[model samples]
Target: MKIDAHQHFWALARGDYGWLTPELPPLYRDFLPADLAPVLRVNGVEGTVLVQAAPTIAETEFMLGLADDNPFILGVVGWVDFEAPDAIGQITRLATHPKFVGLRPMIQDISDVDWMLSKTHTPIFRAMATSELAFDALVLPKHLPNLQELVRDHPDLSIVIDHAAKPEIAAGQFNEWAANMVSLAQNTSVAVKLSGLVTEAAKDWTVSQLRPYVEHLLDHFGPTRMIWGSDWPVCTLACAYDDWCAATDQILKDLNETDRDAILGGNAARIYRIKGAA
Candidate 1:
């Protein structure tokens, strides 16, 4: 069951993607599953985990609706009012839907790095903990410690750190990001998305430029804890879907078949809890 564990969906007119800019024109418009499925077929990916790129609960519901209709969408990581009084109720309700696998808050949008670390967010964290869903931290390097603490409180919950903490690979700031990643990976239960690297590199970066980050993640998380993601149209800012698929292939070409299988799909199937009859 080959899976891309971290992907996105959005409508441009919704004005939801805060990161979408004219500079990121490629991803500024609609990127529905219809636009991406062909690319998945070309890449030999069977199903995907639709991650949150929208900024509101309405967007989460909308994506959930899409997932309900789309069989290829095996799992969804939707957003919610993490601080809402009904936080637990909402997650409990959403969890009944098989595709609703996890939840995410746009932690990167908050100016204060510790916003999610506050006591205010504990109920929401605990609710997700009770439901046994992942809290996909869409955060930056600075927020890892806070995320680490969140994991500590909810030991039963899984934390999938998106995009290797969205590292600044283009600027080539490797050491600090590498250290933070190593520290986070030390948490046995935390997993990582081996996606979104193109956005961190030069638009036309060669495979060599991405080697160190990929190597570090593979070295830290190993094949058992890391999964691949397309980051899709967002990836278009740096490379196309085919380009990313090709790069991922080359980056892991040296691995044994089993390790390669784990990075590509085995770990994703296990982490996202996708049950494929094969």
Candidate 2:
């Protein structure tokens, strides 16, 4: 099954998407499953992992509601108040729903670079590990060290690094980012997502420009540890769903079918524990 492992659906009226402003013309409006169905169909993507766009638990519930209605939505990576004293309780409740596969802390948006290392959050991580839930690291290059520390602290947590830590492709520099990624991958338990790169590059980015970073990820993480994601609607900011899909295909064309299958869908299924697909 071909699955787009990382994507988002949001409603503007929810009013929790503080970062999604009217200034961003393409994504300022609502993006629902109906809007994405045709795109996924045309791209030959059988299912998707709907991710959180807002940090509120309300938004997570909203996505869960959508997933309940859409079989195409295989699972959800939603948000929770991880820093709250009652975070374990929240996680326990959310995990009852089979579709609640993971949680993301939006580490990149938080001002404190060392926020992940806080002692208060350690129990939350422990709870997540106990629940067998995945942790999506929505981070930037600078936060990678803290991420490394996080992996060390919670070695068994199913952590996936979103956007390859959102590399500096737009500026054509990835020395530090690459080094950090290499360090993190040494954990062997961590996984990386091949998504959101186009939006990080120049508006008219070519496949060649993205090749080095993509190749770097494949080389460092290997096909088994890497998963593909569309990062849709947000991807529409720089390229269409088809454009990103085509670009990903071109980049992975050199691989044999087994490796290609693993990167595109197999890894996501195994990592997220997404169900009901043959």
Candidate 3:
């Protein structure tokens, strides 16, 4: 099954996905299952993991409610206040939900890019060890060093690097991004997501413009550590869902079947510990 491991859901009326308004003009409107299903069908995606876009427990509950009705949504990487004094209880509460597969903190929103390396967050991460939950680093390249340090301390934590460190491909800044990417991927516990490259490139970019970034991730992380993600409506900023999928397909056309399968779905299933698909 082809699994798009990174996608999102939001209700504008809920007023939770606020960061999207300024950075994601194309997707400022509500992006429900109704809006995402067609794109999935067009791209032949069989299932997806609904990731968090806001920092609210209600957002997690809301995604759980949606997952109940949508079979395509196989898992959810929802949000919760990890640093709360009662974080252990909160993690226990969230663990009861079958769809709750992981968590995200939106590290890019934090002022201190190195917060992941702090001792304060270690306990919160340790709390997640109760259920062995994976954590997505929603961060930029600047935070990669901190992430590397975090992996050293929490060897069991499955940290996925979202958006390949969000390269500055639109401006052709590949060398720096590549250096950080390689450094982060060196941590065996960490995995990389091959998504959001189109948004990092120029609006009128061709498939070739994104190949270097895609190939770099595959080369550095390899198939076992690389997973596919659609990034959904945010991807609409540079290209539609179908366009991004097509570009990715073209770029990997030369790879062997095993590697292709890994990037498309196998890696995601194994890394997220999702049942059946792995």
Model 2 segments more than 4 A misplaced: none
Residue range 58-163, candidate 2, lDDT tens digits: 9999999999999999989999987677789999999999888999998888999999999989889888888889999999999988888889989889999999
- Candidate 1 error regions (>4 Å): 18-23
lDDT of 3 by residue, 7-107 (tens): 98898999877686656566777889998898888888989999998999889999999999998998899887867888778888888888788989988
By summed lDDT, which 10 consecutive residues of candidate 1 come out lowest?
Answer: 269-278
Model 2, residue 40: C-alpha shift (Å): 0.6
What C-alpha lDDT do the candidate models reach, one value each? 0.84, 0.91, 0.85
From the highest TM-score down, the ranking of the candidates is: 2, 3, 1
Q: Please report how far candidate 2 places residue 22 from its true position, in Å.
A: 0.9
Model 3 lDDT, full chain set: 0.85
lDDT of 1 at 154: 74
Tell me which residue pairs clash in candidate 3.
none
TM-score of each: 0.94, 0.98, 0.95
Model 3 TM: 0.95
Question: What would you estimate as the lDDT of candidate 2?
Answer: 0.91
